[model samples]
Target chain A: MSDKIDNISVGKKANVFFDGKCVSHSVFFPDGSRKTVGVIMPGAALTFNVGAPELMEITAGECQVRIAGEPDFKTYAAGSSFKVAENGSFEIHAKDEVNYICSFGSD
Target chain B: MSDKIDNISVGKKANVFFDGKCVSHSVFFPDGSRKTVGVIMPGAALTFNVGAPELMEITAGECQVRIAGEPDFKTYAAGSSFKVAENGSFEIHAKDEVNYICSFGSD
Candidate 1:
């Protein structure tokens, strides 16, 4: 993310739901933008249902991801990002404690 | 952070102030606890005047830190944590894009 966009004020708290594989915190900005930054533990797989457009970025570590309708899982590493459409679902297999940021947009 | 603490419901948004070296998002919980997760860019140095006791953890990358009255800065890397007393000030030199979590306690 650009330093300009990151310079905004982050609003109230939000949480990410996962059994034990991942932990995330929601960040809202004064411009009404929101994102979540969290960690995904190693050797775990998780599937999530999305309600809006989501952009998932890997900040640290690596993971294999299978977004809905994909034929096979693909590798994503630090500095990589993928997008999921509204109402889509995605699966993730973590290889390490993966640090990530998920940005949501109305789309 | 443990999975249980990681499972927390992250509350409202907060912003961190820095010229261009770092960006952080504030996280609040229902229990009135708070934290901020952020990134410190490479080769940047910053000093902060803290009002409460703060526990800072390096989740990714590396940094050299000098807490108040500390004779020298210590190098810290991933999974390392340090504490700062209330009303104390600290300086940091980032060697990379350092990801961290700063947890604050009343005392």
Candidate 2:
């Protein structure tokens, strides 16, 4: 296991592994696991697929999370927590920019 | 497993099971596992022992986390993440009433 903590700045990106799948631009823990926390600027969007169940908490601002093929997006505000199953495809859009943390099981 | 999501208010308390010890006032996910997110007020203190390694992210404010018998305390600021091993004793003090999220593995 890689125990490296990486701090990525705005406009920069990193890759995180979730059960062998790659989630790009994911802020990782020091252990190089799938768990991460970072800020997402307004008008920004990210898409990825998770291989294990995932949990996220909206710490600041607000964002819209849409699961693939799902109608109607979910609005996540500060202090909100939600879960996504493994192998679920997700896309996140920041309405006015927001910061959130995401964690998932290790491979 | 209990897949219930509970919303807790300030000055309120809840119990979370880590391994077998009771960690009080822990905000849990909707799925009802150890993973949680909540706010810790200033001057407020909490003590608990985790059974699995924990990952926490400070979404707002600042606080001090001190492990049992540790000489000095570690300060966590907004946008910072840290880990605590399972079975490790820890105490958290909000320097000026901060809000943060704490998550851990299930039993």
Candidate 3:
């Protein structure tokens, strides 16, 4: 993974969720696809609803994640990734913090 | 300003400060200059040290700001902005979360 994403349009406003436990900004690409660059604060576990298939790429920090229908929470650290299906949901916990790039419709 | 900033490269990693009270992503322009899109959470007053001169453009929410050398705090709302000189500092308080685009070196 690269350190930066080049040539994109990003919204000025941010998406703050769970009382700021999760925050993300929308990024738009030339091909019309979109993604979000976000940071999840290490706090109480947070559940995320996936509208489309998503590929969560962790760039820094660590997280324990459990996808819907999955029986266990897996650990993902920097340079690691995981996926969730469309219309699914997941629970994530970060003991410190998690910086991620979330790609939608990644199926 | 427009709802989005186009044709810019942004770092995947974020700049999280004040225990996540202030979070920003760095955006690079083709001209080699850089800016940040950030959110100031509603909580305590936060002081930001300026490296380059910065123009803080408020996109949403509200804030009371006091630039260094200034006597009183000024209120800035959506569609408004404030400037800080290089090497100076400023203190801001947001009763509600403030969403902003900060353009640097705008002198």
Q: Report the lDDT tens digits of candidate 3 across residue range B1-107.
A: 68999999988988888888888899999999988999988865899999989999999999999999999999999999999999999999997989999998858
TM-score of candidate 3 restricted to chain B?
0.93
Model 1, span B1-107: residue lDDT tens? 43113323342222424533455555555576767776676788899889989999888789999999999999999889889999999999989767788899864
Q: Native contact fraction of candidate 3?
A: 0.78
Could you give the interface RMSD of each candidate, to one decimal?
12.3, 16.6, 0.7
What are the per-residue Cα lDDT tens digits for candidate 3 across A1-107? 67899999998998888888888889999999999999998765999998989999999999999999999999999999999998999999987779999999857
Using TM-score, give the best candidate's number: 3
Please identify model 1 stretches exceeding 4 Å from their true place.
A1-107, B1-5, B9-14
TM-score each candidate: 0.50, 0.36, 0.95
lDDT of 2 by residue, A1-107 (tens): 11222232111122223211122223323344544544454566777677787887776678889887789789998788777777888888877535456778732
Ordering by TM-score? 3, 1, 2
